[model samples]
Target: MRQQLASMLREARHAAGMTIDQVAAHLLCSPAKISRMETGRRPASQRDVRDLCDHYSVDTEKREQMMALAQDGRRRSWWDEYELPRGYSNLIGMEAAASSMRDFKSSTINGLLQTEEYAREVISSYFLPANPALIDQLVAVRMERQRAVLRRDPLPDMQFVLDEAALRRVVGGPVVMEEQLGRLLAITSELPSATIQVLSLRRGAHAAMDTTFTVLDFPPGTPLKPVVHVEDVFGDMKLERQEDVDNARQVFQRAADAALSPGESRELLEEIRAQYEREQPPER
Candidate 1:
């Protein structure tokens, strides 16, 4: 929501042929303040929005529309209660509004599809010497995010392409993994708009071998650009440039092309689950 407002404001500013400094001068504010407003680093006040719209000579109807967007941007998301890192919160905001998404995971299950036990285990592993309360909060946030797939008015179309190694990684334990696999199957059955595919090891050394990323597509009426999100140990990065987004899109397509079909992927998942069940220890 904030991104949508920022994009529209930036576009209007550019169309007006006014420099940031010039806008700052007109509004009697520092250039940094103007920059933050256009980049969504800070909230834009109603008066500030009106002043900018007037300066840009935006039609009254469009100006009102932008103001409405600004108002919407002020509403807090449920994730806000978790006190997430800035980068994570920004990505969640974008994800909440995305109409479709393509995800590639090379190391582990995507957060959106993780079952509660799987998510708890993954979080515990990462935040070793973990705080139990914090771990619970993190798990809750992830579970809430899964609602995007189940959203009904206009369901989000989602495709996940996973490296086969991810399935074999053995998160939690055999029983936990078995449950996770079952959850994945349930998700596919319940959400027709969601798909899961596996890129077998046999398709060795493919593109995007070292990266895990997601590309989010928004509805057409807004000025929001398609964004590619990349996360690493350092932090998360949002790629908005046309070239970067295009490259990410192509990478996802290539990986998807190399993955097993949805039916085949489900069959493989079942086989893996059976292996886990067989390996489970007998009653003590």
Candidate 2:
């Protein structure tokens, strides 16, 4: 597979009438980098694929395939052997390729929505034995996944419905929780493609009460089926069956309906943030 990709890169480069040195100069990288990408020694980055496609004047279809191949290379990550925990790599891959995503978390803040401090606290609490380097790597990976929320065209439309209690639970203490809530509001306000809804405790229990899950929607003409990721401590359940997927979709819809709207959710966060502030005594 790598060889085929390498051959494609070389073919595209040759067709453009551009020398390796020129391409390397355009990319602002070493000649060896281009050589390795063409030889399959290193997987192509999305930027590399885009630049080459433009230089080669490839059609949309061919360009999309090459870029998708580059993305797929990252999906089969080698991070598993490092004991990075189960299901995380799968989550990253799903987030990377999903055209739309809906998440309902009844417990702590979802990793995708967490601030670095909140994430660090959560990781440390769960992986008590992990060293600083591993913790830092895990946090970095989580932040990288969050970038999906900001990507341009072909970016996923993200909707998150969090239980209101989750907002006030103080996952990493009042300071971290406050920062997280503020970050959530700021992100949603800035990203028109994203939505954050809060499922208030007063609304009573709903379909997403017992468990947390995510539904990932794919772009049109995608080869694989749409999947639902039901997360648990042991491992996650990847549901691809039509019936199961439908059921999860229905659950998410109901939860969204019960949750506060984007505007109201922001107001809710502001209120919580203020309340936490009031409860915190001023430093001497």
* Highest TM-score against the true fold, candidate: 1
- Superposed on all Cα atoms, model 2 deviates from the true structure by an RMSD in Å of 10.9
What is the C-alpha lDDT profile of model 2 across 1-284, one tens digit per residue? 34345657887887888899998998789999998887555778888889889878988987888887788665545343345543565566567667888899997778877899998988787675768997888887777667654554655788999998788787777777778888998888777877899999999978889989999886775543577899887787767678999999999999999998888988999999888777666799
Q: Pick the candidate with the highest lDDT.
A: 1
TM-score of predicted structure 2: 0.71
lDDT of each prediction vs. the true structure? Answer: 0.87, 0.79
How many pairs in model 2 have backbone atoms within 3 A of each other, for residues 3 or more apart or on separate chains, i.e. clashes?
A: 0
Query: Stretches of candidate 1 above 4 Å error?
Result: 17-22
Scored by lDDT, model 2 comes in at 0.79
How well does each candidate superpose onto the true structure, as a TM-score? 0.92, 0.71
